[model samples]
Each structure stands twice: as C-alpha cells, then as structure tokens.
Target: MDHYSFFDRDLSWLLFNERILMEAEKETLPVLERVNFLSIFSSNLDEFYRVRIPVLLAVHKLAKRGSSEKEDVLLEAQALIGYQQQKFGKIFTGQLIPLLKQHKVNLLFNEPIPNNIADKVMDYFYSQVMSFLQPIDLADTKKSFFPENNRLYFFISLRTANDLERNVILAIPSNQLPRFYSVSVADEQYILFLDDIIRHNLNKLFKNEVVTGCYSFKITRDAELDLKDEYHGDLSEQIEKQLLKRDMGIATRFLHQPGIPLRTLHFITDKFGLQSSSVVEGGIYHNLKDLMSLPVNNPLLRYTRWAPINSYHVTDEGSLFDHIEKQDYIFHAPYQSYNTILRFFNEAATDASVDEISVTLYRVASDSRIVNALISAANNGKKVRVMVELKARFDEANNIKWAKKMKAAGVDIIYSDKALKVHAKIALVKRQVNGRDKYSGLLATGNFNESTAAFYTDHIMMTANPLLLREMELLFMFLAKGKKSAEGYPVDFKHLLVAQFNLQSRFMELIDQEIANAKQGLPAAITIKLNNLEERKLIGKLYEASQAGVKINMIVRSICCLIPGVKGMSEHINIRRIVDRYLEHGRIFVFENNGDQKVFMGSADWMNRNIYRRIEVCFPVYDEKIKAEVMQLISLQLQDNVQAVNLDTALQNIRIEPKPPLIQAQRGIYEFLKAKSDN
Candidate 1:
C-alpha cells in the first residue's frame, strides 16, 4: 500500500452520486421532497454519462499520453455506475413513485384516464400544447432525428394497416410545452408528463395509420464541445458555433425502454453510429427529471424554506464596510443573506469617493445585480474592470452576452486567455476617506450568481485589511498587465494563500507540520471540507500525513479519489459526504498546526485546475469566532450518520458506519447555528 496510490477518480465520483441517492431514500424526508432528490440524481447521472464517462472512454480508446491507467479506470467506473443506476432505479420507481401516491400525488403511466380529466387534458393540449407538437414519422424517412441536448423523445412502435411493421420516433415537444400538465379529475389533481399527453393523443399525430403502444425514451449525447485551436479561427466564435453543434457531440448513452424491439434498437443504433452495448435500459418514461417542475402547491411537499438570515452586523447595525474596517466579517450564504454582499457592491457603485472597482466573473446569473453594479460604477466615472471567463462550462453563452452588455456600459471588460479560466471570485474597491486612499475587497467561495446564492452554501469575506487589499490589487494587475515578475504585485501575504505562488506549497507545509506533530505523538489532526479532491499531489500529501498517524477527516461533496480507513495504509484517514437542504459548497481547510489550529476558507478546491491553473484566493480566518463557526460545521458534517456516506478501503459508499441514533448533520448544523443566533 504505497502512500501515493489511491482509489480511481471516476469510481470515487460514482460513490459521491450514491450518497446523493441515499439522501433521496431517507424516509424521514417528505415524499415530494424525496422526489426532488431523485430528479437531482437522475440529472446528475445524465451529466456523468455526457461529460465524465465519455472522457474516460475516449482516453481509454486513444490511450492519450501517459494514461496507462485509463482502461482500468473506465472499467471500474462502468461497474460502479451500473450498480448505482440499479439502486437509483429502485429508489425512483419503487420508493419515490409509491410515496408520491401516498400523498395523493399520482405519477401514472398508461393508467386509464377518467373521461372528465381526459376531456380537460385534451382541451389543455389543443389550446396550449397542440400548436407546438410536431410528430415526425421515423419509418417513412430513414433520416434520423437527433434529440436536442437533455431533451425527451418518445419511440412510437406502429403496425401499419397493410401489415407493414414499422417504428417511428416522435420528438416530445417538451421544450416548447410545460413538462407537467396538471388536470383536475375525480377530485384529484393529477400531474402528467407532457410525453404522456402526446402518448394519449397518438391517433391525432398519425392521422391515417393504426397506432400501437408508444414507449418513452431519451438519448444523452456527449455535451462536451471541443473548440480545436487549429480549426477555430476565433475562440468565442468557435465556442458559439460548437454550442449549436453540441447536440451532435458523439453519442455517449442511448437511454431507452427495456422492451424496445430488437429490430428497432438495431436500426436506431446503426443510424446513430452507436456500436457500444452500453445502452441503458430504463422504465417506460425517460427524463423524469422534468418532474422537478411539477406543480404541487403543498408547502409540506418541499423542504422547509429558510430565508437567508442576516449576520450580527447588518441585522443589528446598518453599515457593512463600516463594520468591515473595524473587524473582518465572514458571511455564509443561503443561510446568511447574500443580499448583504450585494449591498456592498451597491454601495461601492454609488459612492462618490470610490475611485475603482474590479471583479472576476466566472459565472454570472442571467439577471445579475453584480453586473449591473459594475456597469453603474463605470457609468459613474469609476474605473470598473471586469474579467469574465468566457469558457465556463455550459455558461459561455451567458457570459459572452453579459460581457458585451458590460462593455457597452463603458466597463473595461477582459476575457480570459483561451488556455486558462479565471475562476477566482474577487472584488476590489478603492475609496478615498479623509484624502487617504483606502482599499476594501470581497473574497467569495462561489460565483457572483444570485440565483445559486440561495441554494449553494458559500462563504464571502468582507475585509478592509490593507495587506490583503494590496495583494488583491496586485492580482488584478497580473490579470490586466500580464506581469511575470513577483515584484509586479504585492507578494507578501502573511494572511492569504494566493495560488500561482504559495497556495500549493503552503498546503503541503501545513500537512507536513501535522505529520511531524503526529510522529512526535502530539495532538495532530486535519479536517477539510471542499467540493472536489482529485489532485494526486494533494491526496498523496494527505496520505503521507495519514500514514504518519495524523488523524484526517474530509467532507468532500464530490469527486474524492482517496481511499480511507485502509489498514497500515490510510488507517487514520476518514471521509464523509453530506447531501442535504443546501448544496455542501464552501471550501474550508483546517490544520492542527501543532495544536494552534490554523483555519482558512476560500473559493478554490484541491483540484488541479483550482490550485495551479486558476487565480484563486484561500484566505485565513483572522476572526477567531468565525474560525470556530466553520470548525463546528466540519465537526458536525464528520459526525453526520444520516445524509452522509462514508467511503471504505474498497471505495464502497456505505452510509456512515451506522450507530444507534443517527445525526442528520446538515439539519443539525442549521438548528445549531440558528439557536446560537437566538441565544
């Protein structure tokens, strides 16, 4: 058991998805809420096939440079996903469907529609949905219809009146129509997928032909759009062109009904050039993730919504930066109001004394107040520089749109170089107070998108620390001026760990200190909560510390490759994942550091892209109270028996080494924090 070796990355990611499925299976959750989790699982797996599995398969086929482990990684990933998909199916149709019925919310398939409801459904379809419905005959035209990315399609099997057997694929007009068609029938409100509405009306679609049963199916194509540098004249133009061609990216998974006739399957597969036997056989309907949009007005059917609570400063006192100058304030979002951060931007935009504002946009919301603030600042004669990453996955188009808008408003917009993405969430504001130039900055663990700010548990730190502020100014200079020399920026950061120089080394130094302390038989330990932990070097360092008897606890929300609890190998390492109310985002790294307990929180995870390839900032928790708060969160997550899954030596996702009474950590933490504020 070499310290450098660990579990395969893809297999570990599958284990993380299994943890999400486990949350959906928790009986304590309300029925419809469980349904939401199932939809999320289905959606997540669809992405896994489209993005991840294809990459692994491609590497295995090409045996790209130095990927000797590619074939084995792919095989292990296939096995793990196959097993998890089986479990996902059981949870969805077996548990979720029956449970929905228990709440009088029935998701029916081919169940005879009552006359009154069928009439209403027909009327609704004719008025609203019929205009958009365009059913293509697959038999007449051997021409294949490619389903749009993540869109639903129905395969219609028909026997002609002349005894000519044929199969036709109908594109369910779900993109134009509402996914859920609600009808009031027999005093029950039934929600039907739009696919069902088309299924009920097959006769109307195939005017002259006799109709047979319609089986619902969908195909998830490789969504990764490759903008080849040699082929693409312009990066933005190539990306835009590929966005249209993304539907045609090599087909990864042909998800279909289990009972599709052999002939139909062969014809479809051959037409689509699908040579693999990895066709996923699902139940009648595919893409039930659309059920997430189902209209169920019952408040009890969803998780109890909590409006973002205010921090001690904003709720008790009005001014944000005023308190920031006195002491650095840490804000945890989705729990703490993100509006406060918005207020910071809003104030900066309107302040007459503020001279400049700079921010990096990785992913901005469609209607972003942050963008609007930048525009307002530029309009007010302030130097507003925005570095928007145009290569953000699936978000390139939105970012391009906003970049143009911001540029039109006089913002000095800087798009990233094609090779690297600027993922750092940073905002620097320069103001003049009493004829002295003062600097304030906001460092965030998530995007500037307000939409996700409600569902993603992230942290934003507001500080007036001249040391950090000056270093941030240097970072912006590096982005704008492209200075290679260390002296071009304020390089001395005693508090912050900025990538490109000290982040990786500082992390190793912290881990080595823990290992040395453990070797000395001191109280040495480390705890990390991050979104991803796939970088081999970081994992190896942790393993080294673990082997040296340093206790390690990690609560990684996704893509963990390290195998924990292996005897004499990783015996002191433990890993758990929490999938609950809000997304377990926000990267927090804690080091025992010879029992002084150094803690840092930031936007960057331990992934290769985050640590080296992007400009990220991991800031220290100078405020002891906030450090304790974050530490408490890691402690609760590690202790969580419910809504948390533990990874074993074999990389099996076992639900937290079960104890008598389980602690559902996320809920417990919420209660714990809310109670603290109340006290």
Candidate 2:
C-alpha cells in the first residue's frame, strides 16, 4: 500500500473541469455550446470554492510546522486554477466572441458601450437597474455591511472637493435583474453585461466626486451546513435555519478584478475579514456563468435539439403498472422520454388499486410534479410515506418546502438523521390484488427531478421484481424509524446493494469473484461508470483485481482518485471521462463471472460519503433484456472517440483522437434509442 499512489481528489477534480474547458476549445462544436461549456466550467469552479476549498484551507491550517505536503497541495491547486482561468479568458475572447461576431452578434466582453446603444443602455439602466442598486459607504464603520456569497459588487474609489478619498461598495443586483442586456441596432445584435451598464452609469450615482476606479469582485464562501448529530430540533427546520447562514460561512475565495491599489486592497480585505481567503486577481468581469443566458437565440449556434424518444410507450387504455407487471423496462433519460416515469407516479396517485406509495427524495425540483403526485396520492386516501433528505447540499430549502407541503397534505414525511442522507433515487408503489400485495417500483441512477432529467443522462428502470421491491420496502420501513444507524435492523439485503449495510462488502465480493476467476485462467473483466470514484477501500480492491489479471475499464465523469495504468498495481485498468452537451450522471457496475455477466445500476458513487454515510441503493439487473441494453449503452460510451478522453495517471484528460467513423456516445445513444423507438 505504501508503494501504491492515488491522485489527490481536488487535483483530480480540477482536471475534470479542465476537460470541460477543453470542450469549449473544440472548433467543431457550436459556438453557443462552447459558450455553455465555458459557463459550466465557471459554475463548477465557483462550487469548488464554495465546497472543496474550505476543506483544503482547513487541512492547510491544521498541518504541523514541518509538514509541507498540505500547503504544497493547496498551492498546486491554486496554480492550476490560475492557469485554467487564463485559458478560459483566452477562449472566450479569442475564439467564442469572434465566432459570434461572424454571425452578426456582438457580445460586449470587457469592451466599452458603443455609441449606437448608449442611449438605450442609459434609459434601461435608469429605469430598471437603478432601483436595485444599494451603494454602501465603506468609510462608515457604523453601517457594517456583509457581502453575500457569490454576489457581484463594485469597489468604487472616489475623491471629493477637498481631495478627501472615500471608498464605497455597490452591490450589483444580478439576483434581482438580468445579468445581460441585449439591444438591436440596425439588424445587428449587441449584448451588454449588466456590470458594464452600471459602470457606465457610475457618474449618475456620484455627482460631486471624481470616481477614480471601479473594480468588480465577488466572495465565495464555504457552503457546508453545520449539523450536529445530537440536534433535538426538527431536522427540516434546523436545515432551513442553516441555509440562511450558508452564504455567510467563512470566505474561501476573494476574486477581484486586477489593478486595485495595494493599500486599498489590504484595507478592503481587512474590512471584509477576508484575511484567510485566497485572493485571486481575475478579469474585468466576475461571474461569467451569466454567459449561459446570452441573448443570442440562433438555432445554428446551438446543438440541434434531439427530442426525447418515448422508450416505454404505454397505450392510453393500459396503465404503466400493467406494462411493468408484464415485463421490466428501462428508460435512458434525455434520450428517452421521462413521461413514463411521470406516468408511473401519476398513475400510482390515481389508480384504484394502489394502496401505498413510498419514495426517497434527495434533491427535488423546485416545482416538482412528482411531489405533487405524492400529495395527490395522500389526498386520494392512499398511505404515502416519503423520506425527504433535508441535508441535500444547496437544495435544502427546496426539499424542505416540498416536505412541508406534502406533510400539510397529510402525507407521512420522514427526515433522515443529521448525520446521514438518503441519496437513493427509488420509489415503491404497492397495490392490493386479490387479497395479496403487488409491488411496482422505480430505481434510478439520478434524481427524479424532471428539470434535470431533460439534460442529465441517466438510467431508470421500472420493474415489478418482487425480491427487489421487498428489499426496498424493508429499507423504507427502516428509514421510518429515523435512527442514526442501520445496525439494529437486521434485514439481509441480498437483491439490493444498500450502503451502510451491504453495498461496499457486496461490491468487494463481486471484485473478489473476478479476481478468483482471473487467477483460475478464466475470462474475467469489470466495467463501471460513475460520477465520482474516491473511496479508498474499493479502489484498493480494484487494484488487487487488476494485479490478478482482471481487465477493468471505467468511465468516471469526475473526481477519480484511482491512478490507472500503473505498472504492477493497476496495469490492466483504464478510465475514460466523457463531457458533452448533457451531463453524464448514471452509475453502472458490471462484472464478468467467467462467462456470465452481472450488472448493477443505482445512485451510489464510490465516494467516502456514499459508502459510509448516505443511504444509497444499487440494485442488480435481473432482467436479461434490460441488462443487455445497459451493457450496450456502456459499450457505446467505451467506444466514444469524439467526447470521451482517457484520464491518464498524471490527471490529464488525454483526448481519444477521432478514428475513421467517430462516435460521440451521447449522440450515438440518442440515435440508437431513436431507431429502437422507430422499430
């Protein structure tokens, strides 16, 4: 183990983001799509600051005086990020902006407002933007203003009549107003940043003073909610209280535009108590995630929309339950219609036979139709029990809001303990048929949120498998107890690999089986796809299997700590990462038992939190047809040369160069599903 090495998780994550930035550099993609990739990269970096940077800061602080490893990692992360930010700016200005100009669209990136649109910009600023502006005099110590996390602000330096200097902070109300303003002048489109609009209008606000400098900046704070295991209050209420305080957490990154005087920068830093933060000098504009909302709506500048195919078409006469009861079905999201999933809940809500409904809601949509269906089921006199994870990061408020609504509608709401979260995306529907209980269920690899389903590539299986549903039912019953641990409930989960009980052990056993087979001179292999792979124990097992001559291929979308393709350790293992139009989010695990293959898919990533803390369900694929389809999809992704890149041991995303007939997995999956639907 001492000889073996693993990539640092944060550095690996930065490499994943670099993959996204690489997408923006592709000359073949649509310009708007490239802009979108840029937006995603920026947004992902903001989240890293809000989440991971705080941990790194804590690690750096706690390291002993003689130890430099922690500090070195922190500095390396900062340097890599600085390099990526420079590359981001170049791609935006050098490539994307010029491409937009060729299409007769001018996106004003760090440029002055042209004379043609000056009047309109002024009029719009005066009428709309001025109302949201709140300027704080930084000189006034009594006022004490705290900047919210990730909210844009302008640090204004002013000189008065007596040459007395005054510094002020003006909040850019991007939350209250649009981040960009678009105006058309004589058949040409011009897009303006709201920051620039307010910059141009600084004189209108400060009449008697000379505005010396205005630089845009934002503070990204740690987003971890403080939850005590022994907390006695209602978990949802406690989470709501913490959500308000989340933005006020310790600042991790202080990003400001360059050219601020050193004296003023120190003064501002001390003033905001950002002494411990990593101060990054950035471009003129902050929060370029607003580039996603650029007012250019040309169809040619975007990826041609592929309408979701109807995978499981339920005839109007027959219900979704009827189809599931006959045979199991799988739906690939964004490529396959999510309506069948909706109809599963919709029919369960109204069906006369359904007597009870159970589900686990992690991160729900704001206006979730599935929650509405659960509320309807409760109102329709069915027993509805929902385990809503109040600890879903950044989505605590929305989940709490829906939980209260469902509880008000007489639905039984169960909240997981503060120490654990229910991350399983599963739903169970029980019906009374001929004096016996019949169960139909949905187990998915992603959240049951329709909004994300439109763009996140995931897999959902609708099944009437009694064994799996029975195990799921037992798990829900255990969840109803709301205990902090899964120890006392002694139900053996044979069909479903549930975290905190059998998930890690069962996966170890599966890998061990492959290792044994490989040792016996039999054919053995493993394939897995996940959003992240960071758990060390399982990674060690994979390494052991690789040493045993078991072939392993993995597609990890982000944060892979396992150093693949190493000599004498993981020489047989290869990892690929795919980043494209849709977010690749489904988790699939396959192991070859000599000639027979076993497949499993669910919400669990091989991360520390998923293995030891969260309640996750990874169920085996029992149906041969569905298993074949899942294998085929994984095969397509493995064959992808266009969007897939091999994640080298050095943490670089090495592009798999195009062969003769290049295959992009997302596009190929859509076409395959479309052809399947056509047949």
Candidate 3:
C-alpha cells in the first residue's frame, strides 16, 4: 500500500471558512445576503477558538518532548486565520458597506456616528440600554468580576477627581438589546452599532470622571463539558451544573480591539488569569455575528424567497401513515416542506391505533412542535420513549428543558451513557393494524428540528419497511439499557448501517467491493456527501480504492482531511464544497456494485466523533423511485458550478467557472422537485 498524507484538520476547517468568505465577496449576491455570509464566517471562527484551538494548544504543549509538527500546525492555523480576518475586513468595509449604501441603507462599520442621528441614537440608548449596563471598577480589588465567555465588554481608561488614572470594565448589553439600532432620516435608513451607542454615552454614567479611551473585547473559552463516564448521579443535573461553568471555562482566546495601552492590556490579562490565552487584535466591533440582526428588512435587497414546495400531499381524510404504508417516500427539506415530517409525528400523537413511539432527540428546537406532539402522544395513552441526548454541545440546555417537559408529561425519557452520544436522527412508531403490529419509521440526515429544517438542506425518508423498522426498534431497545458500549448488543443490523456496530465496517466493505470490481476491469465508482470528512481509516480506504482505479467523488461542506488528486494515492478522487442560501447538511452515500448501485442516507458524517463515539443510523434507499430521486439530487450537486467549489490537492476551494447552462444545485433541486410536484 502507498503512504498517504492528510491535511491538518484545523487548517482544513479554516479553508472551509475561507470558502464562506468567498461567498461574501461575490458582487452578484444581495448585499444583505453577503453580510449574512460574513456573519456565518465570524460565528464559525468563534466556535473554532472555543472548541478546536484549545485542543491544538494542548497538543502543542504536549509536543514539547516530541517533534515540532504540532507547533507548526498551530502557527499555520493562526497565520491562516489572520489572513482570513484581513480579507473579512476588506470585504465588509470595501465591498458590502458600499453596496448597502447604494441601496439607501448606511451601515456604520467602525465609523463615527453622524451628527444628524446623534439625538436619536442617544435617546434610544438612554431609554432602552441604560438599565442593562453593568460597570466594574478594575482598580478596586475588593470588587470581584469575571468576564463571561463570548460576551462583549469594554475596557475604559478614566481620569478621576484626584487626577489619578482608573480602569473599569463595562459589559455591553447586546444580549439584552439589539446589536444594531436602526433609524430612518427622510427616505434613507441608517444603522448604528450598539457598541457605538454605548461609546457615545460613556460620560453620562461616569459623571465625576473624564473618559480617556475605551476598546471592546470578548473572551472565548473551552466549550467541552466534563461529564464523567461512570457517574451514577442524574446526568441532566450533572450537565446543567457543568453548563453554568461553561461560560467560565479557561479562556482560549482573548480577542480585543486594537489601540489599547500596553499596561492596560497586561493588567486586564493578569487580573483575569488569561496569561495562556491567545491574545488577538480584532476590529473595533466584536461579535459581528450580531450582523444577522441588522434591523433592516428590504425584500429587494435579499434573495427572492423560494416557497417550500409541498412534496408529500396529506389530505384531511388520509393520515401520513396511510401514504407511508402503501409506498416509501422521501422529502428534501427547505426545497420540500418539513410539514410532512411534522404531520407524521402529529398523526402518531392522535391516532388511536398508535401503541408506541420512539425517537432520538439530539438538538430539539426551543419552540419545538415535534416535542409538543411527543408530549401529546404520552398524554394520548401511547407508549413514548425518548432518548434525549444531553451532550449535544451548545444545545445542552434546550435539550434538557424539553426532556424535563416530556418527562413531566409521563413520557419515558432515556439518557445515553456519558461517553456515547446518540447522534442518530430517527423516529419509530408502532401501530395496531388489523390487530397486528405494523410500524412506520422516519430516518433523516439532519436533526428532527423544525427550526433548522427551514434553512438546512436535509433529506428525510418515511418508510414502512419491516426489516428496517425492526432493526430500528432493536437499536432503541439497546439504547434503553444505557450500556456504554455496543459490543454485547444482539442486533445484526443487516439493512441499516448503524455507527459503533456496523456503520464503519459496512462502509469499508462497500469500498472494498468497489476496489474489487475496479481491479476486475469493471466500472466502479463511489459518491458521498457529508458535513465533514476526517476519519483517517475511511479516508485511507478511499485512497486504496482510488489506487485500484475506482472513481470517488465527495461533497464535503467542511473539514476534509483527505488530500484529493494526489498521484499514486488518490488520483481518482474529487471533492466539491457547496455554500449557499441554505446550509448543505444532508449526508448521502452511493456505491456502484458493478452494475447495481446502493444508496444510503442518514445523520452520520465520517468524522471520528460520529463513527467511533456516537450512535448514528444510515438507512438504505430500498424503493426504486426514491433511489432514483436520491441519485438525481447527488448528480445535480456534483454538476453544480454556481454555488459549488472544487477542492484542489492542497485543500483550497477552487471556483468552478461557468460553463454553458450553469447550475446551482440548491436552486436546481428546488426546480426539479417543483416540476415533480406540478406533475
């Protein structure tokens, strides 16, 4: 076998973020949409600092006695981020702001407030923002203050009555108030940052002191929860306690606006014990993810909305279960309405025949109609079992809230072992049809979240396949035991590929089959779409198949470690990345078994966390029509030139130039599904 190289995961993630920046740079897109891409880029970077940078820093420290490989990767990551930040600044200031101005909307980006709107800005601040402001005098050691993670604050330099210098920290109330304040003067609209609003009114709070300088800053902390593997206590309570400390975790990045005095910076760093943090000089405004709330609603300055097409028709007389039992159905989300899936749960909740309901809730929506329906099912005398994953990062609180509500409503709630997270998006319902147990199931590529379903492109399959649903019920049964490992589980899972048991091995076997056929002088190919691609073993297997003359194509939205188009290793592999109005989130796998092709779609990405640590379900497309639909969707994504970019050997996103009849996969999928619906 040939030796292969992989891109550093952190650097590869940065490359993905850069693709987002590229979308922000497109002049043809609506200015606000471009601003949204910038917001997404900023938000993604903050997550990297909170999650990945700490891991990198720890690895760098551990490598003190080893090679400098870890240190080099860390430095390269920093350099790449710095370059991207500079590019972000140029795009925001040089391109987007001007475009907004052309549309009679003025966005104040690091600029002083105009004199015309001074009265309106201060009036709004005095009435709405003053109550949320909390200032701590850093000079007074008796008063204790800890800067919360990712919350914006400002360092103030002041001269008091005694002519002595004092330092104070004031928390920006962006959490309490809108980040951008909008006011209309005549026919033009002007948007002001809440940062500027507070900056303009500092003297009012400090009546006896002279404000010298003020700069904004925020701290990014490690987001990992410290869940013990063998804890006998309530996991929900344990996670809730950990979540309170999440904002106070050890700081990983101390991002501050430039031009702070050196002594002030050091004093603040020492006071907060941020000595080991990555101190970075950022823009005048911190947390530009707030740009998503620009407070301007101009339909003409945004992408014309595509109404979600009703793909699955559920009549008043017929329940969703009636359609599923007759034939298999698939719905592409955002392009197709999520109401069909919602109605699946809604019907199960009310149907007198439904005897039991089971599901895995990883990330539940805050106002989850699905959870409400589950609660309703429990009240309707149906057996409800929910494996609520309390370990879903950043969503621990919301999931816990819904779990408690469901438990209160007499629903049987199951929690996964601390070490294993059930990332599967699946639901099972058992009904008594003709006094016999019949089942209908839903397996999807994304969360069962109605909120995310509106903006995230995902695929959901509603089926009555007995073999598949029986295996799903067995998996749920295994989860009920709260076992840390799947080693002793009796389920074989021949039809469904589940992580921790058969998902990885089955995928490897599929790749091996492709390699075998390629070596036999037969046409062999593989296509996969995932949010991330990082497991080295699977990547190596893909390389081995490529060496055997199997063609591999992948659409990885972010974090690809496998270096494609490499000589003697992965010469036949091609990777595409698509970023557009909707997040490309569905995970699809296709393999050519000589002449017969097999397709699987589910929640599992090839990331190590998904394969080795979590319980994920990827089910086969057994129906010929649904199989053709899945194949056609992947084909469109592979042919996309407008919103898709190819990953080169160096892992850079290379734009696919416009050929004749250029295709944007998301739009094309919508149109394709629309025509089908019309027919």
Q: After superposition, how far is residue 120 of candidate 1 from its true place, in Å?
A: 1.3
What TM-score, computed on C-alpha atoms, does each candidate reach? Answer: 0.93, 0.98, 0.98
Which candidate model has the greater TM-score, 1 or 3? Answer: 3
| Candidate 2 TM-score, C-alpha based | 0.98
lDDT per residue for candidate 3 within 1-679, as digits (tens), equals 2477888888999999999999999989988899999999999999999999999888877777585554447778888999999999999999989889998999987778888898988899889999988889876779899999999999999999999998889999888888889999998899988888889889998999999999899999999988876777899999999999998899999999989889888988998999998999888898999888788799988899999998644555677788889998888998999888998999999999999999999999999999999999999999999999999999999999999999999999999888899999999999998989989999999999999999999999989999899999999999999888999777798999999899999999999999999999997999999999999999999999999999999999999999999999999999999999999999999999987999999999999999999999999998999999999999999999999999998999999998989999999999999999988
- Model 3: weakest 10-residue lDDT segment is 64-73
RMSD, every candidate, angstroms: 2.8, 1.2, 1.3
Query: lDDT of candidate 3?
Result: 0.92
Q: For model 1, how does the per-residue alpha-carbon lDDT over 1-679 read when each residue is reduced to its tens digit?
A: 2436666667777777777777778898887778788788778888888888787767776665665654547776777777877787788778887777777777765576667677888888778777876666765565557666666777777777787767776777777778887765555678777777877887876777777656666777788777674663656677788888888777777888778778878877886677753577776677767767878888888878876665555553645566678887777778777777888889889988789999999989999998999899889999999989888988989988888889999998876666567888889998888999988889888988899998898888888988888878877887896443333465666667877768888899999999899999898999998899888888888888988999998888888878788777688888877788889888999998876899988888888888767777888877788788888877877778777877777766677566867777767776766777677
Which stretches in model 1 have alpha-carbon errors above 4 Å?
1-3, 62-67, 138-144, 157-167, 230-235, 315-319, 482-494, 657-662
Candidate 2 — which residues are off by over 4 angstroms? 67-72
